[model samples]
Target chain A: MQKTTSSISNNISFTRGVPALEALPTTLFSECLQAVLAGPDGKTVLQYGHNGGYVPLKQLLAEQYHVDVDQVLIGNGSLHLQDMLTAQLVQTGDVVFTEQPSYDRAIKTFRRRGAKVIGIPLALDGVDITALEEALARYTPRFMYIVPDFQNPAGVTTSREKRQALAQLAEKHGFYLVEDVPYRTLRYSGKTLPLLRELNPERTITVSSYSKLISPGIRVGYLIGPRDIVKPLIALAEDTTLAPVLPTQAAVLEFHKRGYFERNLESLKQLYAPRLQAMISAIKTYLPGIDFAEPEGGFFVSITLPQESNYQHLLQRAKEQGLLLTDGNGFFADHLNAQANQAHTGDRFVRLPFCALTPQEIEAGMQRLAELVRA
Target chain B: MQKTTSSISNNISFTRGVPALEALPTTLFSECLQAVLAGPDGKTVLQYGHNGGYVPLKQLLAEQYHVDVDQVLIGNGSLHLQDMLTAQLVQTGDVVFTEQPSYDRAIKTFRRRGAKVIGIPLALDGVDITALEEALARYTPRFMYIVPDFQNPAGVTTSREKRQALAQLAEKHGFYLVEDVPYRTLRYSGKTLPLLRELNPERTITVSSYSKLISPGIRVGYLIGPRDIVKPLIALAEDTTLAPVLPTQAAVLEFHKRGYFERNLESLKQLYAPRLQAMISAIKTYLPGIDFAEPEGGFFVSITLPQESNYQHLLQRAKEQGLLLTDGNGFFADHLNAQANQAHTGDRFVRLPFCALTPQEIEAGMQRLAELVRA
Candidate 1:
């Protein structure tokens, strides 16, 4: 269906920005569904589901992170948790620090709540921590939001020192820290690090989801934080969705307990690693002018291209050649920049999601992009 | 794996609310997941899912409604849509009317948005229209929240005439009508009537779910309204769970396509219809003074117990007998009665959910409830 839009439509692209539902665990999902059906129908879906998520999934995550289960509070999604976090803590005009070019949705969320956003440059090693420390000193932000592992668009993980330092900073200041690790489990690299929650659970809200690892369609993700804080979040959740669907959670629990989660992640990583490498290698060869970081893990890679306007034009060109890319303008917190007012030069860059494509597709898409840039 | 809680004794019941994830539909879920896997991972989850929901499921719903695809805006659940709707339309102290004792979560949602809730008397025929019309004439209500067919708490549906009159009133009054019908299809009766949307799609926000009919854990629901209203709702959807999970949608779509949906519903009616009757009969026979509406269909029948707070105190006794129930305190717009310095004592009622039990279990549970009321 053709959906009409208002001013906000300029901020998002459903037809172009959204990738097809990819690499979901249909076999395991179906297997879980069958198991649930084979049992009894009455108690599974109609009765209330878990306050947290399905048990085995929670336990699996707990074991994965080597933490107590009390720290996790599964919700409808990371955003659902984010909505709660902002609602409880963020007063109107309260400054919430973040990367200058982070997930636009989070920016929108805070802005919608009337929070003043403090944007720090997205460095090769996460957000500008110096700016954050200073903001913590001066603005005393309600909290700082970061996708520490394989951050969206930027694809940069913070250094261990930065993680430790941020934790220290949070402990000194009374502000809560919300670390979203939706992409953490989708690691392409062989190495891993301790989560922010591992360092300090008291002040941190750590949220992740099965959507990336399993499927997003189930609308599953969770957050963990202090009980006093989580109470409001849960109360907020109660108001918003009452609870997550019982049937899907049951299916997800089985999927995890049945050992579908780990096996599927390994297969997913195996499939994605080369595609990431292919995009990185292709960027080095073809799009030499842009500066970006290729994440060691996760689905995104960010690039800083020379500023230009009309990303839609570039997007249209790429689409004509059977390739797709999201306009960089779509990801910014602020749409209008007096400095960004130059036509054809206002739009600086766009995100190319190589993870959604094959090595072949990535190569072809990049080639088409290369041609478009040259043209 | 032990979760620490304030409510936690040394004895752990971590398993209490946890869903039996293995109970959901894995076979169909697996099919959707299989497509997401072996395909593009990024596009599957990372790329935008539809604002309303998965297109196929929406199409299936459209077919069920015999309406065009444009009418539906799928949400995380009826509750999530409630939050978004309030965010868009409600401001502080705005008047909102609902059934006196209705769905607690919906009440909580509007109250959280700072709406001045005016609850009308509830009944088997639906909400008291005389009180509703008086409130409509007296104050400026942004919307009315209704559960027409086999509603929550009071298990009631609007007559066809009332539905039409409500729509006509909304048209005359210039207030939006937020109709939550998650339980519409879950009727115990063979016949149901026309919906508020049939009379006025432009002014109505129709909420329905697969939670009751298919599964709750899947956390899938939809909002059908005008494009002008729904488009912004979709943008709001983007910042929420992004989209419902692909696996669940895939499974649900397949279920709809394969004609399993109608079969499931038919079988459910046969299985639970007797249970509903048995429970209703027992309540009528055993409990002398309890006032309640005998639901035609759905999971619950609402009972308004005689003049006393004894029913509220009966919760603990019921739990001692291994039975649990939510009190009427939950189903109000304001959980607290500002008029009385105590939690609202509209405590003379409670919702009785009967779908989860066999007829024998229904009879047994009712007998126990009867004993509590008598004592």
Candidate 2:
């Protein structure tokens, strides 16, 4: 599948979850990297760093997350943290829960570890609480993986009520809530809800990365969890990558220290907000029959076609027109196994990412998509 | 154990395998990094990279190693590569064979994955062939993990004949040979030997990293193996860190393209050679009774105390006198489990690394170590 995607040329890709290339603060990031290389700790940055991460970076992250220093464990990226957490908690055949259309790579990670993943249907506002409770009661999974804020493919933020309910449920059921908040800070609109960690500190393990917020290529992220769980993870991390890349860590720390991180994030919001708005408007203008909830922030806008629409055929037609978007069937676990109702519903959905495309590109791409759908 | 080591300060550290800070080509590296940032592909460097790694870097490595690009998979570091390989190959309760005194961290990774590690004593040339054959006969391991080039903590490189024998044995026995050669490029003196992969490409997976040769903090490494073995590892890597840090990969690619890598490596060789020589000379002059095999290259020179000597007590005395080195016992898998003969023999060894310190520090530290051993 990746090979097929790579073979496509001269196509506008709405499938990737990356930040727009035009929007990346490359010049400023380079300056920060150069500053780190010229600094007093330059030599130290070239050596093997602490397994948990560079202390200064951890301290800065601690302040931002409003957590103690020990709570944070740095990784190559949030994906690496997810891998570590899965390795630590889930053994083969152990049940793990996730949203039906959660992040695909994460589902791959959990499945690779041989965890039996059960996906609960996601409501428009969040995870379906009743279904989640039923799954929890049935399987009692090792952890419930959730993307509360602008959940990846779904692009729906979990409501405040659902967040609290889920957190309370985790505590009540004695299962950990793995809150993946990579897109949390990218809120272009709407008031922020309380974090799962804030709701149930002891039972919640929050994972976030600099990939979406800073730069994906830097591959720096952190896991904030209980000390007992985090301690073993640090040891596992030592055995994994030994540590995160120190020069990148140093570069990010310098960027934050120079007060560029907040400013850069603000600039990103300005850059992406309108592109997202353009996508929403384009969807409404062209694809009249498509159903989608307007996403306030984050990368994706998922559109469900009419029941009669053949999404795979439409996708192929759109590809022929040189626009690449993700088929929603790939996002659902049950679709892979050909589960009847879930797979049927999955065939009607397609995810369009607004973050990596220009506003013009978004509009044109959507036009092409709508043309294919209409045909 | 990590905490205990971190607490000891104001001592000349002979335990670390990292390259000397004074010798890194920081200015040149910084320039290369900046060049990459300013280049046309700068935005691509900040975006998510391919799971296999940046293609140009892989091509460069492929040319250097005389392998196809698909044969190479870049990782966060060699340790990360090891973890990926382990996850791909080993299952819980699987047997894994290693040198009696192997790299402690790799051993930890294997053990943490629930592989029962069996240690075969290493001869002056390499792993004792007799023991290896006996172990193979007794149990079929998932893989034989070996650091053939300047084996960590032992500083012994395998002979060409021994390399061929191990590779042939692996093929004959129908098991894989995992050759870890992080220090392969750091040869200060010695004729190059045939790599394990060269002898038995079908049965050998060679893992090497830039950590020792270029910079550990950048955390770049590659695995060259059969495509079938590598394909699964690539999927596991995607599930692991998604990909290696892209900015560092770009920086390294730029450095290599600009021909700074070879120059920097030459500089490192020049810097480390004399320090290694100084340590050898100091050991002869100050610690007369100690036995050690002179290493032609790489970081460590392991010393074995006289049979009656209490190495742990001597280590404490050396620490008190401001010299810190790794206890060789930690390197042996049997030591952790209190296995008799191997554990007892491990107690008599200590490893001193010459790469991180200056010639003066090596001499002074060795002298202090000699004084403590004499007491």
Candidate 3:
């Protein structure tokens, strides 16, 4: 598989959940880097920074999020914060809850920290509340992780009513809620809802990043939470990396200060919204009757295959046709209490990320996928 | 103490172990960032990079170290790699060993991971071989961490003979050695010794960073080791941060490719060498008969206070004289096997880092210390 995959050339990949290359503001980044290097705090950017983050960026994020400076802690990436949180809270045999078909790396991170992950199935609007309540009654999770806005892979955004219920559930269960909102600002059509932290400040830790908005290469993400959690995480980060990268953080701050983020984000939406529309229309035209909710915003659109269809065969065939698709099994989690392995949880699904592809490319890829499914 | 320390407007201190601001090549960094942004791989620099590292930088390091590229793994900083290694290997009740006066953060990181850290006392040349051997005989440690080149807080470089012996002992006892060499290239005098990895590549995991030579703010460090260790670390990094910061990594690669690193290293040595000289000379002139070692290179010069003198009192007095100093006790590890706490192990020592201060400031600081000691 590795050999065959590597041998293929000129392939169109839907595996990446990254912004388009054309969407990156290279000139703006260069200008930001230059400005930051020439700025008053130039030397500070080249030296070891505060363990929690670059201070100016923290202040900026604090103001933007309406939190005190002490409540905001920055990291290398949002996943870095998630990994640290898992390390701090979860131990061997501890239970963690995630949305079914969640981000695979988060699942792997929690499991690596020796936690048993039980993924609750997600409805079109949000994570299934009934299944979540049943799980809550059975096990007390250290934390529940969710990408509330434009959830990854599944492309499901939680409704306002579900968000309120989830917040109340967290309060009753006494478990922390990790509200990851990497795709919050990228909404193209849907109205924005209140953040989970706003609904339940006591039990919510909000994680967001400049990756989706500014650039992923800068590697700046932040966690706004209670000081008790933030302080220990600061110590952990200090022990690990001493501090996050400051030069890029300063560059990001300069970009934000120059009001480039808003403009860049607007251009990004313009660049991506049409592609999303193309993907949905292509799915309808090529793979009619496929079960997948249309995402209002975000990078992905996952479709469930018929029960008899094997995802691996489809993936390999797609690769042969120079169309790369992400396997869905990786997104699902093993049950904590199951005596036997649940091997087919996400095997009958496939994820296609629309952000990195053009409308034409998305159409072509879907056409190729439909041919494989019909075969 | 916090209020008084914060209230002071002016202070001459030896607490920080970072490069002098004057030595930072801000202009060169700007040029490098600009060049990288305009280079052929410009778009790649703004996207999520390989979990292992930016490929060109890894290739450059691999070529420099005379190893395959796969053996090299870049990290946020060298300390990030060290912390990950500790997490992977040192489980609860695990025994780890370090020099008596080790880097404070490394000690804290190991202790936080639930490892019992045994401090091996250091002689002038290096760590006490006799003590290390005795500890090895009693407890098989997960790994022995050493600064090897310019030991942190103590500034003791290992002799060639001691390096060979340590390498041999690692092989004989079947224990790994983590040779951290952040200050390897900052030598003002004395010939360079073979790296521990050079002596025993099989048992040595080398961790070095660009923090000292290039800039800490870029946060690029690397590990060169066997595939087994490097492979798992790459997975862990992916699970955590997805990738290291690609923009900074590309900037560093450009810096290295353009030969700015060599010029920067030369300037840094010129900037820091005189300060080290001043610190050594001041110790002899102002604090005559003080027990200390004259380091050939590196950032620090530590002196042992007389047994009757309390370090807390000296620290307080030093602060009153508008001076800041690091508490030495933080560098010493608590014994895993001892029945009682080792309260006074490093209390009789104070570490002075010369890199951040000017020659004149070093003399002034030493004068103030001498006055406080006499009073």
Docking class of 2: medium
- What DockQ would candidate 1 receive versus the native complex? 0.31
Once fitted onto the true fold, the runs of candidate 3 whose alpha carbons sit more than 4 angstroms away are A1-9, A310-312, A335-344, B1-9, B310-312, B335-344
Among these predicted structures, which one has the highest lDDT? 3
Instruction: TM-score each candidate.
Output: 0.83, 0.93, 0.94
Of 2 and 3, the candidate ahead on DockQ is: 3
Candidate 2 lDDT by residue in tens digits, B194-289: 889889889999998888877888888889999899888887787678766888887888888888888988988888899889988987887776
Worst lDDT 10-window in candidate 2 chain A: A1-10
Residues B1-375, candidate 3: write the lDDT tens digits. 012223334688878798888878889999999999988878888888885999998999999999899999998998888888888788899999988878988888888788989888877788889989998889999999999887898888999999999999999998899999989999999899999999999899999999999888889999988788888888777777897798888889899889998999989888888999999998898888877778888888998766555455778888888878888878888533221433225656789999988777787887777777773
* DockQ, each predicted model: 0.31, 0.73, 0.78
Candidate 2: misplaced stretches above 4 Å?
A1-10, A312-317, A335-344, B1-9, B312-317, B335-344
Candidate 3 lDDT, A126-208, residue by residue in tens: 98899899989999899999988888888889999999999999999999999999999999997999999999988999998
lDDT of 1 by residue, A1-375 (tens): 111122121222212322224565555675676666455642544345545655555676667666556555677667767877788788788888776677777877888777887665667776667767766767787887878888876678877878887788888887777888988877887567777777777778887776677766566677777777766666666656777665566677778778887898888888788978988987777677676777888877766555442244776776665555666665565444314533212155556566666666666555556666763
- Badly placed stretches (over 4 Å) of model 1 are A1-25, A32-47, A185-193, A246-263, A287-291, A307-323, A334-346, A359-375, B1-48, B186-191, B289-291, B308-323, B334-345, B358-371
Q: TM-scores for chain B, in order?
A: 0.85, 0.93, 0.94
Native-contact recovery for every candidate? Answer: 0.49, 0.86, 0.85
Highest-scoring model, TM-score:
3
